[model samples]
Each structure stands twice: as structure tokens, then as C-alpha cells.
Target: MSLKASDLKVGDTHSERLVEDLKRTQLVQYAGASGDYNPLHTDELFTVKVAGYPSVFAHGMLTMGMTGRMLTNHVGDGRLTKYGVRFTSQVWPGDTLDSTATVTGLSEVDGVKLVDLDVVTVNQNGVEVLKGYAQARID
Candidate 1:
């Protein structure tokens, strides 16, 4: 059954964690796929030497991808109207990440119902890494 926008309830929480850690190969694959080769994200030596970063970091889009997919996977297709996110912290390989979302508000406009989400991502240490809002149309 398709979950319409109104069907999304507020005060609900869905979360997933990365205790296994993200692999370096996967991070390289993401760099190749997303075409975001910032030295801090692709070149470990550059990240350490030039950028003073400990290691290459995962692209923020990669994490946000999981977030959007989580919503669509739960609600079904053609239901997203607005999706936006912000990277609050850097994600490195071996860092376990947990992503979650909760409904914060709902509205209807021009016959389309819209829902806003309070999305967040945390690492193994419980540090907040990413957080943002997403708006989608109810199917």
C-alpha cells in the first residue's frame, strides 16, 4: 500500500546504524560514482598532509542518499516533493553512522500534501554528524 503524505505520523522515529563501518573501497567507489574528488575525500595523503585531516571522508551526499532512500523505501515512490540536508560533521572510513528521521510538520498546498522531516545522523560516539529537514508530497 502506498503511504500518502498524511499517512506519515509525527513523533515517529526510524533509525539505522553502521556498526560495521564503511569500507575504503566503498568510499573510493562513491568518489568515482559521484565525481566529488576533493582531496579531503579521495586522497588520504593529501587529506593528512595538506588538509590536516586524519583520513579521506565520505561524501555527504552518500550519507544523505541513505536518508532519502530510507524515506522512499518506507513510503514508496513519487512521494517526495522537497529533500534537503546539511553536513554537520565529517564522516571517515571506519566511523559507524546512524541515520534517523522523524516527522515534524505537515501541510497541504494546491492539492498536494507535504510533510517535513527532522533528519539526523550520528556516529558511534553519539556525535551528531549530519542533520537537516526534508519535505515530501504524500502519495
Candidate 2:
């Protein structure tokens, strides 16, 4: 459900499953769609044999996009005013990621109701993979 200014409290929280067992093929598709075919994302052999990572990992943008999807699901279309995130940890294959947002502030700006949310995304092991904030118009 979309949030209204009156419906939000400082600690109100919402979560959504962002990804289940993130796949290499999905990473390749994201690379193709976003033109971010960095070898680190698409090349497992290179990453493991050369770069020394156990396997290829998901892109930060992919995680951020999933967080965006969570916000959109909560706020509906065209309601977001500002959103940004910081990548905190690597997201690996076979990890389930969940996006969560907590209401942080509520105010009226020029007669428009605004809601501020603290956003975070965590992997299956409960490690924060992304941290961010989003502001949206709630009418």
C-alpha cells in the first residue's frame, strides 16, 4: 500500500524480497541491459582464476535497482522525489536479498507532503549490502 504522510511514523518499516539466489545469467542480462559488462560481473573464470574472488558477484547498480523496486512498490509511480544509496558489501550468487525502508521523517514542503525513509538491503546472512535514503511525495 502507498504511504500517506499521516500514515507514516518515525519507525514504520516495510520490506520486500529483492532477489532469491541471485544468478550469473541474471548478472549477464543486467550487464546487457545496462551496458555495464565489466569483466568483474560477467566473467566468473576471470574473477576466480585471476581476480581471486570465489565467484562473480552482482553489480552495485543491480542491488540499487532492486531497492528502487521496493520503494516503487511502496510509493507507487512518480511519487519519489529523491533517492540515493551506498554499497556496503558485496552481493554474491545464491544470496537472497531483501530490501527494507523505515520512515525517518515527515514534513510538508510548499504544501506538498513529503516522507523520508532510511533504506537498507540485506543478504541472506543479514549483512547490509546497501544503505540509502529516499524521499517521496505522499500527498
Candidate 3:
């Protein structure tokens, strides 16, 4: 499902629901898989009492990964040449997330077509949690 540069424009977009009612179990699993066991992510007691957050929150990387999945699903496997993001807000249990990738640029560099995308992930309330950009090879 490679994107064709000729078929895309700067404002074209693709979106996906990344998660629904995010669970603490999913946070713990991501902690184990990514080796990021910060109490802010998995320790509800510490997060509330000691860390002073409302609750254990999702890892920024977890949200970023979900956003990346949206990008890959839109751009095709192994097509990404660059990707980067900034975590804008905390994601907590029970939050549903939706991600979007909007084409920002299209060009042919050295005869290879490429597309630049602006990526964003927002929670159920429409608060952005992750924002980034990606560049990928296209058909």
C-alpha cells in the first residue's frame, strides 16, 4: 500500500483509532517490553501519593508508538526514512486515542518520490498527546 506522490497533496490525511479505553495492564506490558518501569507509568499508589499525578499514566513512547503505527499503516512497511515526535500531554487509563497523519510535502529527491507528513495523536477529549513528523518513500 505504498502512497504515490502524484496521488497525494499537502493537505491529504489519514487517521486511525489507536486505542480504546486504555488499560493499566497495557501500561504494565509496555513497561516490561520497553524496560521503562517508572512508577509514573505503573505504580498507582506512588503516582498519586508520591509523584502527585492523578493516576499512573501511559508512557510517552507508548503513545508515540501508536502514532507510528498509524503512520506505517498509511505509508507502507519499511517506507519511513525519518520520524520524530514530542509528547504534549499525559495519557491515562480509560483514554481513547486517535491518530492522524497529514501530508505536508511531496517531492522527488534524486529521482525517488517522498512524502513528508505531520503526525498527531489526540485523546477522546480532543487533547493532543503526541505530535510529530515523518518522511517516507512513496511510489
Candidate 4:
């Protein structure tokens, strides 16, 4: 959907699936793509035996990147000026991520329109994985 700053109102929301039934292969692929080759992300044995976690979990940046994908998909590309998130929980295999962005503020600066978004991503169990805010220019 094309969203204009002038047309957006506080509380307007956009939601989409970020990832579904997350798998080990996807994590490995992400590791390759991002060069994050930490064994904790790609090697279950290292994660469970060495790191002492119950199981391997996703890399924080991978989740953050997924959040970015959700944001761009909702509001369109090249508009995001600022986007950030706090990693709140581990995303394990088999978890599905549902992402949402709510319009929180709107403003204009030097004739540039801006839209502020409150963004969040939650797992299938409704546990928040990432939460943050994003600001984008609306052309």
C-alpha cells in the first residue's frame, strides 16, 4: 500500500508475516549472507553443548533485518530514514514471526514529510522478539 504522510493518521496500522516456521537452513543461509558465522546460530551442537542454550537461536541482526523487510514491504522502499529495534527474545526454530507497524506521529521538516512508526515483531506464541520505532520520508 502507498502511504502518504498527509493521509496517515496516528493509530493507522500495517501488519505482515516476517517469517514462518523458521528453520535451521534459513539461519545458516542468513549467516552466509550476513557473514555472521557464529556457531551459536548455525551449529546446534555448539549452541546446545558449548553455549549451553537449549537450542540454536536466530542471530539478532537476522531478526532485525526481517523487521526491516516488513517495514519496507509495508511502507515502500527508500523512504526509511531511521529504523532500529531492540532484540527482546530468542527466536527458535519453528517460530513464526508476525510484524506490525503503527503510525504514531506525522510531521514536516523543511518541506519534507515524515511519518513515524512504532514497529514490533512477535512470535507465534505472541512473545515479542523485536520492538522499536522507524521514521520515513513520505513523498
Candidate 1 clash figure, as a count: 1
| Per-residue lDDT of model 2, residues 1-139, tens digit only | 5677766789999899998999889999999999998889989889999999989999999999989999999988989999999999999889999999999999998998999999999999999999999999996
Per-prediction TM-score, please? 0.87, 0.96, 0.97, 0.96
Clashes of 2: 0
The candidate with the higher lDDT, 1 or 2, is 2
Which ten contiguous residues of candidate 2 have the minimum total lDDT?
1-10
Model with the higher TM-score, candidate 1 or 2: 2
* TM-score of structure candidate 4: 0.96
Ranking by TM-score: 3, 4, 2, 1
Off by over 4 Å in 3: none
Backbone clash pairs for candidate 1 read 5-138
By lDDT, the better pick of 2 and 4 is 2
Candidate 4 yields a Cα-based lDDT of 0.90
Write the residue-wise lDDT of candidate 4 on 1-139 in tens digits: 5577667899999899988999999999999998989999889888899899999999999899998998888778787999988999999989999999999999999998889999999999899999999998886
Q: Which pairs clash inside model 3?
A: none
Could you tell me the lDDT of residue 124 within candidate 1? 86
Q: Show how many residue pairs clash in every candidate, following the order shown.
A: 1, 0, 0, 0
Looking at model 3, residue 48 earns an lDDT score of 97
Residue pairs clashing, model 4: none
